[model samples]
Target chain A: MWKSVIYKEWLKTRWFLIIYAAIGVLAVGRIFLKVQHDFTFNEATNFWYVILFQGYQYFGILKFLPALGGLIIAVSQFFPETVNKRIKLTFHLPIVENKVMIIMMLFGACCLLLTFGVVSLFFYGLSIIYFPHEIIHGALVTMTPWFLAGLAIYFLAALIILEPVWKFRFLYALVAVAFIPSVFFDDTITGGYSPANPVLFVLVIIMSTALLFSGYRFRKGEM
Target chain B: MVRLSRYFLVIIAIIAFSVVIPKFYWMAFEKPVRSPFVMYSCVENDFMIQKSTQDGLVRTDTRGNNYTREQYEEKLPLMYMRQLMISGTMPDTINGVFMDAREINDERSTFRLRTRDLFTPDPGLYPMFESQSGRANLEMPDDYFRITWRMEFVDANTNKILEEKSRMFSAVLYNRGFDFPAKSINGIPTTRKSIDEGYLVIDSEDQLFHVKMIKGKPFVEKVEIPEGLKFKHISCVDFRNKRYYAYLFSEENDLYILTQDDYVLKKLPVDGLIPEEQEIKIYADYFHYNIISDGEGYMRSQILDADFNPVDEYSETWPVKMERTEGKIYKFLFPGELSLSNSNSNYNAFFLNLNKSINWLVLSLILIVIQFFIIKRRNEKFKNQIVDFTAILFTGIFGFLAVNIFPNKFFK
Candidate 1:
């Protein structure tokens, strides 16, 4: 029964994964184009710095992409199918309601992970090509916190929309504001911006945990 | 709820560890030094100019030809050292004399000459001359020449002088071939212009003299009366020595003497007496010889003799008190008339303390609120998603930080 639910969730959002993949490929291609310029070793390093440091701001337009994708996938395929009346059918089919929801969530997480992985890979490749003289072996390693933060934001948004409580929407908006302040950490705050630092790492974890807890409360409270 | 609490504790622990550990490391190993001094040099030659020094060193490509450090230093004067101390450049060297000659006749012509001098020293440094020259002569129509006269000095690093000398040459011509009588005015042709105008007329045989143009008008005789009031000398307060001096000019036109403050026991004159026919003249043995008000609320004339002195003197109503309080220095109440507007903004200890406390409090509250939420949903799918997202984000942020914070550590 869990397998069936996961399969249904995957089938529903397959088109989104395809689109994300295409966009990721194109974005990565643009980064490669920049690498083709004739540059001194220092200039190349500076170019990579600009790409890495400013890439998030450029990608800010895509902030809504994951949340929107998650929302559509969750509302159309998961929530509607798991509505109070329809839930009985799913729960009674040799599987517990909790197991079905968990499987569906896993399926959605897999799709998100795939999308983020592709985007991160593209960034990694660009960094390598542009800063050939500089070592970028740790580029992906440093990106871990940002990737996690992005996923946390997406999950938090989905949870707020799905929650039974009316105030959850407001809470979600507050979290969004809080997220904005965190984004500015890279620019204004000295150590707050870096992902690799233990302090920022902890912050990412705490924010992620809060997002997850909020989602958990919504899921446990009602439909 | 218990599961949620566990999650919250875990997150708090992680954040605390991340923030605290690196800060400890930074404090122990990465504190930067206070001073990072470099040197620079400035030199000019026909082909190229380069300046380099031990502190604030700057090197530029001279297009293949390299200058040795020793050769560059030789051309520069010791007066430039003060300019270097203040991080200023030496001024350009453009010194020459101007000579004008008029023809009294083709072969025997009278002559008059006037010499003009122009030279600028390194801005902040005291200038010392090693050698200088100026001369004037004429070579027929359309040909004019001036030669540098011999002058040399080893400028005292401490004492600076603005010594300038000008000479006017005059002579009369007689046409011996035509039996023309020697041109004489009263006694001598050379004395004719001086006796008539009460001042010398500058000219040579080839150059003709005409009515002098004073501000575009024909020059007229203007009698000037010397005021009975005379100044002994004027000097600014030397903060380094905590003393003042008066520079006095003698009536006999002897050497000027710098007298100590004790020598001027009488109340010094506040206003300067100017010659009726001439503009107000303030004579001080300093670079900036401008009259200004001094302390005691009088519109007294003053001069900043040295580069280190304040660019301008305080106005009549400037405050004369300063004190230290709570480990910080403060200037006392200034007079309303004094211009203290250019002073730097005062430091506010209260604001600094308030900002620091607010930053810490906000950060702590954010941490606490996040922990509370994490603890409230440990077992939910949404909680897992949040954790997954956070893990990825934290990983990314950490990667970014590592790349930046430890560039040398990672690159190597």
Candidate 2:
């Protein structure tokens, strides 16, 4: 049952993944050329250049890929399954709903993670060539917030489309409003840029949990 | 469920309280006031050999030429720059201002004081000057003076006085150096002579007055000495490959260099420039050469060309010290090959406007709102989505103009 659910999600989001991969490759190539054109041989090894390439600016483009992919996947596939009563057939086929939801969520999340991994790998290669001495350890730590924020936004888009209720629409608006404050208070709005405050980590967790629970509640009641 | 609602209410209350309390306190308590009392100080230098123990006294020059200490005590009633609308017994001293029996508490009690020079208000009074202005001015011996002060402060009860507590002050003025110019070379007699120019003057504490004097006539004056201060010797040298003339003043181990043309003074690193071999002190306006000085009795000097620019350098030793009093001190051991001006491109001004927090916040919020409305219209199956988008865009533009653009234009 889990396999079927995962397969269905994969089938729906495979095109998005391919398009994201293409965009990621092109962006990385453009960034490399831009970096090479701007800096001389010695200056290319500067710490600021490495940070700009591997950190905020690189993550900024990476974040959009997930948001766009998540929106397309949620609106076209996830919503239709509920609105068209296709979820009813799946629910009645002796498959536990939670397991099915988890499978579908994991499939979507994997695609996002894969796209992020590819982009990061490209950046890592550039960093290695240009700045061998600079440590890439901070990149992993920085990318976590972007991943979490992207996941939260994806969950929000999923809940908004799947439920499509007036009251739930208001709740969705509230979720977006909650994110507005994070743009000012947290660095994730600017492509997962951050100062590594623990409070921001708690905020992301709380927001993500709220979105996931809302999705679960909508699935349990409306569909 | 009851507890959950109570917790939610508490959270809302906290947010509301945080937002409202600051605004309330700002509106109720924060009021502007015009500060009273304008205090200033002046230092005079006398270079003549006649004076012995008198090293020239530092005088407190007030804004209104109100110099007498006893008169300042009597006019303490009018010292308060503001008169409040409400009546009460004015405090004797508020923020070190001796207030007389006058008080007021109206909203219009604030008045700013206009500060002016005592001697001559024309061309303005500088920290260092030679002689007094106008023909009938009080004239005396050769000396220079600089004065600085702590200005007046208005009392909370609307009374003001020029009170002396050495805290909460105005400005400080002090004399710097003497101006003397010469057009001829040393010992060689040409048609050139010395110019004795008098610039600023002040009264000394010893009831005697001093003026700044330059030796020789107008065009060939080489030596300049302040009248009252005892000096060991004066030396003049052509520096920076004869681009400018430097007048050196030496007293004991200290050396002061003043330019011949403008009389601008600068202190030289004499100890670092000379090794233990030479006990003589040397001062120059511009030290264009490099000096190698070991602690032992050995010294070497390499004079660079006048057109050579100094190299930029970064220092790791002796961390950059930021102090309010001492200002910035940059210690450089060696210069770098590349200058900062040559390597870095000036940051584009495009980001200058976008760097403000308020602009980005408003833009993001408007975008979020427009996105919300667009999605809402689609949910309602509305055919005319352009109207909603246009309305939101117009409102956002209007809000931006009102909040950011209008106020800046009006205030600035």
Docking quality band of candidate 1, CAPRI definitions: incorrect
RMSD of model 1, in Å?
29.3
C-alpha lDDT of residue A69 in model 2: 54
TM-score of candidate 2 versus the correct structure, residues matched by position: 0.36
Give the CA lDDT, 0 to 100, for residue B211 in model 2: 26
Please tell me which predicted candidate would have the highest lDDT against the true structure. Answer: 2
| Model 2, runs deviating above 4 Å | A40-63, A132-144, A180-212, A219-223, B1-412
lDDT of 1 by residue, B288-393 (tens): 3333322221233333333324233322232222211311111111001111011121110101101111223333344434443543444333443444334323
DockQ of candidate 1, scored on C-alphas against the true complex (2 decimals): 0.01
* Cα-based lDDT for every prediction: 0.32, 0.35
Off by over 4 Å in 1: A37-99, A133-145, A180-192, A195-223, B1-412
lDDT of 2 by residue, B1-412 (tens): 2222222222222222222332343345443321112211101111001111234322232222423343333232222233321223234554364433332111111111111111111111111111223434332212111222322222211122225411221111112221211111111011121222332222222111122323211121223345443222233342233322332323343344454455444444433332112323221112122222222222222222112232111111111121211111101100101111110111111011112113334553565375556456546433433333443343333222212110111111
Q: Which model scores highest in TM-score?
A: 2
The clash count of every prediction, one per candidate, is 65, 69
